[model samples]
Target: MPPSPAQIRSLVTAYLDRHPGEHDALAPLTSALDSAGDPTSRTTLPGHVTCSVAVIDRGARVLHVLHRGTGLLLAPGGHVEAADETLLAAALREVEEEAGIPASALVLTADFRDGPIDIDVHDIDASPARAEAAHQHDDFRFVVHLADDAPDLTLQVEEVGGAAWLPFEEVSSPTLRAKLVASGLDGAIRPVKLEQHAAEHPAPAVRTEPAAVAPAGAPSGTVPNIVGVHLYLERDGHVLLGRRHPDAAYAGGSWHTLAGHLEAEAATAGLVREAYEEAGLVIDPADLELVHTVHMVERPGDDPRIGLFFRARRWEGVPEVREPDRCVGWRWWRAEDLPEPIVPYTRVAIEGIQAGRAYSELGWAR
Candidate 1:
């Protein structure tokens, strides 16, 4: 049955309540969805809604199709069609079309009959081949269990390389793994809770690199890069991330490591100031560890960014939201349990930390 506008709002609202950690991450997306003149239309610009499903077997194996175009494994789903009556209907239709599974063989839990299993909002890369500009997608994810232990399946050859059922741990791609983790299929999604300034420790050691200089060219004194520092705060079994407020100029509603721009000061000093101002944490120059540096350019016209990502092994004060204007709240997250729609560069840094890499770059011409 098609859901009425009121029902749709109720379903989405309850889904967000179950996942408070994503409240900050999905704040603006939800706001736009709720306030739209003609909500649920796929043609909406800047962002749109898509539906996908995580297909699992009785043995807890997940189904994945290797996308031929991008050569990566992804779930079965697509944009909402105008004829679609509801989000669940759209997700089920994609599964049936992409997996060639009979409707009777898919087990839709009654718990999810009214709500999605998870929600992911990610930025879309703008490419000339596809007409989409720089926009985002609020992907509603549902879970379907296979009734039959073994079922006959066919592939959408034009889009998929092959399809397989494997344990969640066996998923090889980092992006795919992160999405699976976010979907809560393996029970890794962490709940949202801000740890107030509870306890304090001595400041950590610090080291920082100098700001990048302009290249040798026609004229002088030009600042070619924006210098920023991101602190990787670690506690007993989790790391800290702040959710950018919905009213911020950029990255509003995305979870990011503690970071701020360098303002006429050394990166080390700037980081210290930002730590106190943003998270109410104090540190010494000696406890900081240089884990990685990211040289990234968001677009051709935007200034390049030289970011120093530090690992703060120890610091004084429990994580807190000292600056309400910048970020609304803070939460401790496991690497395997990070929420969706994180700042893309910050996600790269977290992955680098797990893989023991020292540095990386993004959005640069190869």
Candidate 2:
């Protein structure tokens, strides 16, 4: 079902939170929502809410289709329809209808979950043949990560004549282009590529630059085990986890607890810093209790690391995206029902903590 009037209002409010400067530009939309019978209805005068999808690959290329009606290269999009449940769903449906890329192959970026990356308001020419008067479209633009580097595309020849992937800089929408460049998502290497690199360079002695920097001349070929802190914030039988962005150096696009590597500070101090820095949560050291520890190695020949999980008895503020580069958003999951694609050790650590075990080991040879 199409979104209700209240839903439209909430979406506009969220979008404004991100781009406050665009409030004046969106007045028509707000006014429509205020006076409307149905702002999503095609018959609404002045303007209505429309949606577009931007398909970006791991390499940072965006998909554009030659729109048959206008003979212009554009992202897949159209007016909202009754079958759509949300603006984002409408955008995704349009992509599949016009570009033939199934929903299974696309993952919406974290930033797009709250609202569109861009909202473009523009005029549409009158169509005499269809007996439609001139109007405007408050086009909500969303971005999605394409899983495959090269996917077969079957265009709807009636609306889309051809399709091609273009570099991000060449994207037609100036707002979208600027945002994409600033986001640095184009530089993110997918997990599959990281695995391929590890396979090619075997890991006993060689480590990826991000995780392998040796301490100041300690030893010739020695890689030290890095120590990190994890926060286990539980409320009403649920624990918190954040979905790492695809661009993260480790476990990109996977679920993990709030965590960070310890610096020169004490472990508890480091946890407090990371809590505020990553999730906008303020935790007190006195309220923290040592819960569990995991000694883990990602692979057979890789250097090991120590993860110290600490449970916070109390904390201030709700979990939010303070570091977009590392995580998209934080969600609470039941102890028995966790989401998939979670970091392997993270799952183990959570289970151990629940079982009242203080320490566990993983990825070591028997």
What lDDT is reached at residue 286 by model 1?
Answer: 74
Worst-scoring 10-residue span by lDDT in model 2: 195-204
Point out where model 2 deviates above 4 Å: 187-366
**Predicted candidate 1 versus true structure: per-residue lDDT over 1-366, tens digit per residue:** 223344456567888777777678777666775673444555576777787777767566778888787777777777776545567667767776777765445544323432577777788778667765777887777666665432587887888779888776775434345555565554221111111111110011000111122334525555445567889877775778988866454576888898877645666777788898777899985778889898898777455677788887678988887767557899999987888779898889888887899999999999
Model 2 lDDT at residue 43: 84
Question: For this target, which candidate reaches the highest TM-score against the unseen true structure?
Answer: 2
Task: Spell out the clash pairs found in candidate 2.
Answer: none
Best by lDDT: 2
- For residues 301-348, write the lDDT of model 2, one tens digit per residue: 554678899999999999999767567889999988989999898899
